[model samples]
Target: MKDLNKQFSLILLYALLFQGLYAVEIEFNADKTLLDSKKEILELEGNVSLKYQALIFEADKIFFDKKNDMFSGNELKFSSLDNFFYGAANIVEFSKTKLTLKEVEFSTCPCEEKIWWIESDEVSFNNEEKIVSSINSKIVVQGNTLAYLRKANFPISSERKSGILLPEIAINERSGLDIKVPVYINLRENLDLTIEPRIMTQRGYGLTNELRYLGKNHNGFFNSSFLQDDKESFQVLETDNLRWSFNFLHQQRLNKSTFFETNTSSTSDPFYLTDLGGFMSGLSRTLYLPQQASLSYFKKDFSMRLDLNSFKLTNPLAVNQFQRLPGLKLNYFFNKNNFKLVLNSDIAYFNKGGSFRNNEKESLSRVLFNPKASYLYNQKNYFLESSISLLYQFKNHQGNKNTELSPLFELNNSLKFFKLSKTTKIILEPYINVAFSDQKKIINKLKIDSGLRFNPFKHKQQFGSLFLSNQKDIMIGTKLTHTDKANNHFKFEIAKLSTLGQKILFIEEKRIDLPEPFSLKLKYKTNNGIIFKSHLSLDSKNNFNLTSNSISLNFNKYKILIGHYFARNIEIYNLNNNSLEQKKINSFEFSASVHLAKNWSGGFKFINDLEQKKNVNSVLSIDYENKGMVVGLAYMKSLELDWVSILENDTFKDYHKDRFRLFFELKGLGSIGKPKESYLKRRNL
Candidate 1:
């Protein structure tokens, strides 16, 4: 009997090896095996294991019918080679192209804890299609059944497929109970579309559609929304019943050195954003929306660009701004050794949609040219640079043409001193700049496309003092800096300006004779992930009155910012009267954010009108995150202007409004509400 069994084992091994050479190979091992050649059947018992292609099966017992080329097992456990899927089943049957199982439990999670899984009565997989289908399945999470489905299909690979995305639910004061269901369609590998339908308990139904496309050298998206008979439109603002909004953005690489880009957006009414805006509604508090397009070409030494820019006014209190119908710009650069030269030229037509002089629309055409040249001298401890610039502008309004030219000269010098040791190094730098411009006064009434930047910390005092102005002036500034290898930094800067030809400086519609206005700035950074910055501006002629002051601090887990702005006498535009009026402004701002714990965070922000003793805006938020889930809550209060009362009283009146939001999200699945990160990022914290 022993001799016969040994001969049969050799025969079985040779037969399996021959079959593997030309067709699907099946390999199995067991403690015991039996074969009946007369019936063409094979049986295995005690720890049976089989492997073919990328699939592996383990069972207590297994049987194979050689004539039919099939395999079956009981109390089986199976998995894929990549470990992307694994499961256990009561009964399992598999062939070269398909697999079927009964009373199966499976999951894609790799962790041993098994946070979630799926239970199904039957499950089958098609090798050729790379798809898995299940009947009568239940989704279980944390040992609790969450959902049930009669039939479902899931792809085993990461491929784009059309399906219904998760819906968003929210409750707020403006819209009450709001819900949005979005449907996605994967039209092609490079294109897709999403259509979302929204319902509000207090408002009417709305639809929003978005289309996106991508190519080898181009990409773009279009989004539009429409709502009929918005109840808020008639109840709050008393505007049209129909509301809509649309946005379009596109970018394309025309060639290796050329590019084209365009972005434009519009709304049917001003209140559209306030009522229908998503989580970012708090940041879109502006009264104007911009629309722009540009085509640019670049080379090693030269560049050219064409641009069109416009804006749409969203509020009656805002004044119309000049638009560039079409603008052309050209620039040339030359650099050799320590010498550099640059030439810039621009031409544009500006038009505003409002009647000015003689009941005619305000319009102007401008041509500007600027050229500059510089030379640098460098040494081991000192550096110096000298530059000269010429600016010329030509303007034509109602056929009345005029031109002006100005020349400027400047000198910049800096000295550096350093000390080095085994483990530490320190350096100090002191720099000074002296500039003088020709005594020329250009009398141009319209500021076509230039305006003052309100923030003082963004630019040097001399550069931020005035913009697009042709006046005789002399500016002198100095800055000192200290740095060390220990990641410590400190800086201080001061600047002074002297008007040569004009006795009183005219900024916008304001006239001032403050000759000794200067700014002081300081910044410090430490090695322990902390930074401090402050800026102060004062006018000597006005008893050193503080024009603006700001301070900010940042650490590992917290941030704080505070600011105060005071303008003694400034001229502001009056849209109702079409003129300028002198006014005073005094305001204060505060913002803070902190990480309360490992998985908890909170933030607060507020702005105050000191002159009026009122709060302009305030916001508070709290969030928690853990185990691939997020929950957040927030509240906001804003002061809104009453336009109807303004017209009757000739003054503005403020009314307050409150809003609340709740957010929740489950990672890898979908979200139930808008994420707080959207608005948090807008605050720049």
Candidate 2:
């Protein structure tokens, strides 16, 4: 076959040979040069160098055909440095759609090992089309260490375009496990989508996907994801069904004087959807739902913004939502020695669905209005403040036919104490406010919560404040936190609930940023040290129940926690005690897992309840990679395997063993849709 191809090429060459015309010389500094008598034909021997097409080339020996208008060389090579270079022991052919080299190695480097080539009769590279085609080719990537072959064609690189492309398998071993194949998608420049394509010898399967996006534009960052699985796949959590979630938010305007951020994310399903809307939105398959969103706007002189959020299942068993007063704030600025005005409002809503009056107490809402003004005296430490409320109320079925007007007022004066203290810092503020409301218009009685507080504290840390605010219905609270040497921190807080009106005390190791409120009272720390935190909360009923109780043994090596409640009495979608007691239970769950030595990770979990459970769910997973070889296993309950399927937001008992077992995730390369375009190559106006 090689002899026949050579003979054919020789024939084609001789067919176009032309008569000699003028001669040109190939100089050799040593008074050596090639003399050829032809218009378009030139040849050089012994370290020949020539230039063409804005590029330079060299060869051991070369031949120029006048009439044929062709260049040929044996044992020839060419280099354009980093762009494109090629070398061949035999022949080179160039055309519009193809550049064929026989026995050739091509690469962007000057070295051989990094070169990509094939052992074939012919290899064609097309730059305009970004395709490499080889006939009977054997291809090698990342050196000859790993090889795959075929008459193959592949696109080189993708730099631009957004959205999602069909996922490709990635072999990663960073998660303390060996990953063979993991499916993934390049969502954007900063975010990539990965599917939990986990399959193993000991455990079944699951599905997990990530959502990540970042922008320094308005000083905001948001990262989140959703994952569901029946099989136990986590080292720290054990449950038949696994719900996983993550959230991140940050923002700043470098050129402006405005900055505010908010973040709220959690993984847990405390709701049983009984509404028609739930099934239609395909929201039931997700075990846990997390919501995070923020808003920030800034300008010179006067600037104000907000961060508002709530993450709760909105369904049969629970509902929760919260809005900060800063959730809605306005500010007005004045010149030096001036006063700044601000109006802030906060609101919260929670509900459980069922038969209710036109407006039942089941749907709840609460709101607070505040108008405040501040004056800076002497600019740095002395200040005067005042604020008043126009209305405050929590209404449901118990509300009135005619809305009543509730007005409140206050006057405040404060001074910096730490400045005078011999200590490093200090602050002292004393404020008094009197509030009165007459609600006889709609309510049986009118109540006011106005008071005075003598607050003295060190803003630089190390002091406590006393609130003598019982002027109407005194309320007091204080928090203390400090991170000492050895990277350990202690935090404790006591706050008045204000509703049923009682105080709760919470203590926990301060980790991460601020500190998680003692709603659930769960506390945790690292393994390098032994630390324990306990939190107890009293409900509106005045019953002292353990909201969060956890203990760590062996320096965070083992932990036990028991508690149930959202952080900060969150009103978002969450189950209530009344509904669970009223409805008969209909579901069950079980799970267990172990992470053995040698990176042997394992887990198992199961769930059942045809009517209340989801028909289809995915388990979370990951893969491991080594050098150029990847191994992967992914298990997911097939969408077809669902026992409780929601169609059009309505769930019914439709069991399919096909969708019940789990979906298997396969790992490998091959994307769907279309190949992505390069960022620089893409034209956008």
Candidate 3:
């Protein structure tokens, strides 16, 4: 019997060995994750931790199948396992170039989200394609509401792409216009272009399109607008006017750090002038328009730029159809820091045209090269630095028989000392800048300005300055924003920042009149969160004067702003200096604004010609956003209230007051999805 059994077993083993039969096999790790034989299925449980290709998965249950090369699990989380730098939702699907994340929160290696988690109902991505698609997503970026994107699609491909769209509007005291329609196209990972069709009761059919491309090594923009009807703005030709324009700007890197850039533009029909106030406005005729070009290559130690820009007008207004030319600049630097030299040249030629012929072409050009060196070293409680610069400029015009050369030298010094004793802080800074110009100008045109600033606490400045040139002015100001031990913030700055951020008080006409130009600002903020800022400015050579004030209050999620201006102003912007002359005029202005939580803001402003006893203009605007929906409205009434004052006192008094704005913005819905994506990504653990 034993012999018979042994023979039978041996026969069975032989049959099994020859058949190559297989058995199940598995390996377990201390973490409780298990790997199966055949290198296929991997199961992870009991506080399971699984890692694959820089991706780590953590969940109550996880599984992977090598057969189909698919991964999945529940209560799962996917993250960049190494740096713990990036991750996705409880359910994540990742591939070479694509990532499909569900309810995922990710961060930079250092952990900063701007507003952090980008929440969405669904997010599908393509890694190789650089495509990221999200539906119903919201995020907070730069403290601004970036919300309510419905079926957002961002294309990774450069040649073609589509993304979300946002609409906006503008309301000024004089006019109002609708903005943002059609679709915004993001292409080639660079340019952003938009096409919109709009209609206005005062203006006829119109379509506006803008294309802007900005990238690491290059950038450019092209814009065109067409309108069927015209309004008061065009004043030329007819209100039934057609308007169109195009702009191109490009920058390219010539080497690792060197680059060349050029810009040129053309336009037709002429509305480009009155709307956005572009150079195209200078060309009222189709035969002649405006164009500009510039090219440069340099970095760090060397740089140079040559510009050729002009508006060729076929139809002349008050000015001639001339060419504005030769706007050029060159610069060079070395010695690791300040040891450097610079030379610049500029010239403008004016031509002639129309019944108001201007055959006379005039030009202004300046050449200067300066070499300077400086040393700067500062410590915690004190800082001191000083530098001197030399510059020379020359001017010549065709009409002016004589040429004038101005040589200017100046020394600048800044010093500061700080002391902080527990609850109290103290700071003192004294600055002096003196410049001497041997230019042919009114007597004693040398410029001098000096000031002392004191800060008793952080950001609280008590500043005073005396100026012997440029309007021969003297002023004193103090400003500060502080938060006491009580946890309140007070803020202020007495500097010049236009409501729209424009550098004010520079008169091109009198560039040769003033020896030196200086602007001073003072602002204050409180420990309890109230703010006030004011600016006292002098225009070209300090002939005209201006006082601007801005106030802001912050309380929780609500913020309010108020601005007041008193202008003893002279000269108009853009117009030639000598062409039009007006004495310093008086005006008073007031503006107020309010902002709420979740991106809602509104503002109102009224400018009055106090000398004329009438309101020059007034405007009100409002904008709000609600979870993917954006709405804005504005109203402007310029010189309307003043117009009523032209009537008799009784009639003016009874003129039924003034009308405010009535406009709004709406972001309707449209999508780029078939909803059912056939190539959708599958989940991976």
User: lDDT scores for all predictions?
Assistant: 0.66, 0.36, 0.45
Model 1 residue runs over 4 Å out of place are: 1-102, 105-112, 122-134, 150-160, 233-239, 278-287, 353-360, 450-469, 472-485, 494-517, 542-624, 639-657, 681-685
Best by lDDT: 1
Question: Candidate 2 has what TM-score?
Answer: 0.41
Over the stretch 617-661, how does candidate 1's per-residue lDDT look in tens digits?
A: 676889886664567887767674422112212322112366666
* TM-score against native, each model: 0.78, 0.41, 0.52
Better of 2 and 3 by lDDT: 3
lDDT tens digits by residue: candidate 3, 325-436 = 5555666665545333443333333223221234544343333344444444466634444444443333344434332333444444445555555555545555443344
State the lDDT at 473 in candidate 2. Answer: 22
Q: Candidate 1: lDDT over CA atoms?
A: 0.66
Ranked by lDDT, top first: 1, 3, 2
RMSD for each of the candidates: 6.6, 14.8, 14.1
